[model samples]
Target: MSDSQRFPVAAHALAYMAHKGAFSPAQAAPSALLAASVPTNPVVVRRVTALLAKAGLIATRPGATGGSWLLRQPEDIRLDEVLKAVNGCAHIGSPPAGAKGCPISEHIPRQVGKALTAADEAATEALSKITIADLLDENPVSLAAYTPHASCPVAA
Candidate 1:
């Protein structure tokens, strides 16, 4: 699998919120809660949370009773947005720079590069159609449900 195929923490965190029915237009999770679900430290969750928060996908609160929550309906949040927020790169594979004067990469065709770019565009378009609500409806199984660990992987 490509590096892009690896699950992004933002997606995981959102899915967790969805499964728990924690997605409220005004509600938000505390850094600790997000970290626990993602099975990572608060710092990592904070990073991802900040990204989502910036995208207008989630809202955060300060002081006691403060936590993060979905800022919009789950149906309004696109998978592609989440992917972009966390990964910060095109979903399609990134090609390595070719050696200078390499005939195959340079002279052979521009079509290959165009095709890759097109594929990435198509993928993002398709991903944009999927929303967090779709995932919630599917009853996505949580990693903690099957794992024996007392806390989430991140918390450990």
Candidate 2:
């Protein structure tokens, strides 16, 4: 997955778990189940989940019945927290090395970096107002219960 996609995948996984009521180990959702909802490979889900686990958003277990579950309620898991947890560097590429003796090239990189940093901060601020619960509240349906012709226009 691209670095940019990490945030969405992480958010979706958390919302899915929350929507499915997977709040504890006994109700944990397996990577395959999460993968089905994401329409991606289970390995990809595992990789993303590892980052979430490291961020203390979720917990995972290994072996036959191994799976993952949220460590906190959805309402408490802000989108900013999730984004940071995944560290999805959306479109903030490494700046080119400035050319020697070229004033424009030397200063442009720094200016561009500042702009990118500001944009990232703005995004975090916007997301901080949202939470996994807010996402679930917007859709309010689990993938298991989702339909192409659902009442929600977004889903359709």
Candidate 3:
């Protein structure tokens, strides 16, 4: 999967807490642990964690035994909020810039871009309908569940 297909690292961290039954108003996990859970660089995890913390999705602490915790119940936290905190842009694809060119139909690209934007908004709206609680209800899976398998059976 492309990098964009992957959920935001911050969302993964929050889901991790939720899966581990750590979804509390003041639960915190160390950056290193969260990084390990996501199998990504700690710096990346820290950047996402900082964003979530700023958004009031989670809280963080410093020093040993310090970590992050959910600031609200899983049901109260929407997936779109987490996604927006990590990914500022709604549209995943980029359209040709500027309107100077008139190749093909001038309105075609503009209409397509509008459609893409609408689709992206629809996706965000769908995400808004889901909460961390919904994730928890799905068998307590982790971000690890979404990881690609080690080997590709399709290649065989």
Candidate 4:
């Protein structure tokens, strides 16, 4: 995976939380633990966790006893929401910025922007239909009764 694939990384981080946090008494998982699952640095995990927290998809607590956990149920949190929260993948490439003095530049940018915007919107719509619960490889869960499942283990 590319370093810029924030959507996958963030999705992995969230899925890890969904899997492991379910077993924690606080329903929270540490960033280091989350990073291990992402096979990424703790800083990256913290960055995405902050985004999730700001979007109200997840909650974060500070200090030694604090960590991150899902704020919304898996069934309620859509992939598009998480992508938007992380600014991950929704942008369908930057609009053309080549040859500003050329006649083609003006028309090319306008047309490409329109096309890309439409595509981005459509992709976001498709992503919205998939909730975190849908992404779960295991049966749906209620937070109150959540527990880590062996079959649904998230790989690094």
Q: Which candidate is the best by lDDT?
A: 2
To one decimal, what is the Cα RMSD in angstroms of model 2 from the true structure?
5.8
Q: Ranking under TM-score, best-scoring first? A: 2, 4, 3, 1
Give TM-scores for every candidate, taking all chains together and pairing residue i with residue i.
0.68, 0.85, 0.74, 0.78
Model 4 / residue 152 / CA error / Å: 20
Query: lDDT of each model, Cα atoms only?
Result: 0.67, 0.85, 0.72, 0.75
Off by over 4 Å in 4: 1-3, 23-25, 138-156
**Which residue pairs collide, candidate 2?**
none
lDDT of 4 by residue, 1-156 (tens): 343566777788778777775434286788888888778888788888888888888888877777888876777788889889887665657775868679988678889888888988997887787777766655533223455457666556
**Residue-wise C-alpha lDDT for candidate 1, range 1-156, written one tens digit per residue:** 233422367787777776666666355567788778666787677677777887787776665677678767677788888877765545455456566788876643566667788887886886787777766563433222343336434333
Show model 2 residue runs off by greater than 4 Å. Answer: 92-94, 139-155
Best by TM-score: 2
Poorest 10 consecutive residues by lDDT, candidate 1: 140-149
Give me candidate 1's TM-score against the actual structure.
0.68
**For each predicted model, how many residue pairs clash, with residues at least 3 apart or on different chains?**
9, 0, 7, 0
C-alpha lDDT of candidate 1 relative to the true structure = 0.67
| Count of clashes in candidate 2 | 0
> How high a TM-score does candidate 2 get?
0.85
Candidate 2, residues 1-156: lDDT per residue as tens digits? 888778878999999999899999999999999999987899889999999999999999976798999999998998889888987654667678899899999999998898889888887887787788877774543333544446324532
